[model samples]
Target: MDENKSYLYDFIKGLWKENPVLVQLLGMCPTLAVTNAVENAIAMSVAVVFVLTASAIIISLIRKLIPAQVRIASYIVVIATFVTMADRYLAAFYPAQSKALGPFIPLIVVNCIILGRMEAFASKNGVFRSILDALGMSFGFAIALLLMSSFREILGNGTWLNMRVLGSWWDNWMVMILPPGAFLTLGTIVGVSRFIQTKLKKA
Candidate 1:
């Protein structure tokens, strides 16, 4: 394949086929923890995009110099630096969302999805390719979280993005807003994704 085309392929693949959340099952902690609302999901997605893209760029630029034995630690450090910046930015400008997200912003430092991409893809790829991969992975993560959170928020609160979507007669399912709701929603989504994949393969 042509070099440019290969880069596009790597970037596009993460959005669906090799999605970090649906396919690779990475970074589940924040994926399930902070997605109780659409706003929170969007915030988390932005943070992940900033951290992942920055880490990928840095790691790709220094791929040749980093020793394999210490690459993971180096990647974590790079990811942490970006996460800290993102956390501070949120706290400074969006205090309410920052307070709502709580420790998850700082916890982005340890998100395996970012680190995994740095080690498995960015650390061996060219800078442009790494950026593309990061974009795709971040988009994939965002989409997955948005979908999960949308379902939970809508069903549990009778609202979608804070817009009333249900009738006055509707009784909201309180369970969908609790911790168990996150697990149930994620579990059901995972199962459905697998089912779709299986059907596609069989077809």
Candidate 2:
């Protein structure tokens, strides 16, 4: 019972306490770039979830076998292999999203979030624990991306998931779908989250 609880905690923390995008600020490049639309956000999140989870499994399984001197390089190689698989899969089945995302898909190789998890958690944990951690982190990342994309798409295009939502009388905010919009949303979220945390702590 105690062991399972610990595992649960590991999986839960990344959703908020240690969120890769919101809390740790990792993978901001993809988070901000591909979040202009809900579809792009979902696609990017799926790829990250697949790559992060798969890489964590492999890394944990082979952690001990990797020499300490070359562990970083080894981790990159392993991460790259999974990244390639994800990139190819996306390109094959979701050509439009793949094109929309562009090199960001391939650049997953160096995403600090994945590498950081491999080094900080997966490389030192059991397979089950590592898998949980990866899932948690990826889910957290997905949440942030979704929220960001939702705000951007709805306000900018007056649509949700490319489907028109607002009435014809509504004029969309063009700025909400641009690069600056990403920064504004991210900054606001971070600020609000921090404020909430501070209040909770004071209570």
Candidate 3:
């Protein structure tokens, strides 16, 4: 029972309490860059989920074999391997998303969220726990991306996933799909998240 609770706690915390994007503020690059549209956000989120979870599993399994001196480098190599697979698969089958994502997909190798988990949780824990942690963080990352994308896409383009959400009367806010819009959305999300967390604590 204690073990189950421990696993549950680890998994649940990342969903909201320690969300990588909203609360922890990690992986800001993709969070702000690719979130101009819902499709882009989904592709980035899926890629991150695969990369973070797979990388964590491998790192946890081989933690004992990796020397501390070159551990960081080893982690990057493993991360890059999975990232390459994801990139190629997307390019071959999901060319549109791949093209839209461009260098961002290949850049997952350096995502601090993935590397941070490998170094902090995976290296110190067993495979099962590491997987759970990776999943939790992945979901948290996805949620933030979805939230950001939903807002940007709907308000900016007056559509969600290229499907119209607002009527003709609604004027699309062009700024919402631009770089400055990403900053505004991120700041708003972070601020709202902080306020909610504070309220929850008080309650």
For every candidate structure, what is the RMSD over all alpha carbons to the true structure, in angstroms?
A: 1.8, 1.9, 1.6
lDDT of each: 0.90, 0.93, 0.94
Minimum summed lDDT over a 10-residue window in model 1 is located at 1-10
Model 2 scores a TM of 0.96
The sequence of per-residue lDDT tens digits that candidate 1 reaches over residues 29-126 is 99888878898999999999999999999999999998989988888888888998999999999998999899999999888898889878898889
Candidate 2 lDDT over 77-163, as tens digits, reads: 999999999999989998999999999999999999999999999999999999999999999999999999998999899999989
Of the two candidates 1 and 3, the one with more favorable lDDT, higher being better, is: 3
Per-residue lDDT over 1-203 for candidate 3, one digit per residue giving the tens place of the 0 to 100 score: 57545989779878998899998899999898999999999999999999999999999999999999999999999999999999999999999999999899989998889998999899999999999999999999999999999999999999999999899999989999999999999999999999999999999
lDDT for model 1, on a 0 to 1 scale? Answer: 0.90
Task: Kindly report which residue pairs in candidate 1 clash with one another.
Answer: none
Q: Give candidate 3 misplaced runs (Cα > 4 Å).
A: 1-5
Q: If ranked by TM-score, best first, what sequence of candidates would result?
A: 3, 2, 1
The 10-residue segment of model 2 with minimum total lDDT is: 1-10
Backbone clashes in model 2, listed as residue pairs: none
Q: What's the true lDDT of residue 195 in model 1?
A: 93
What is the Cα-based lDDT of residue 9 in candidate 1? 82
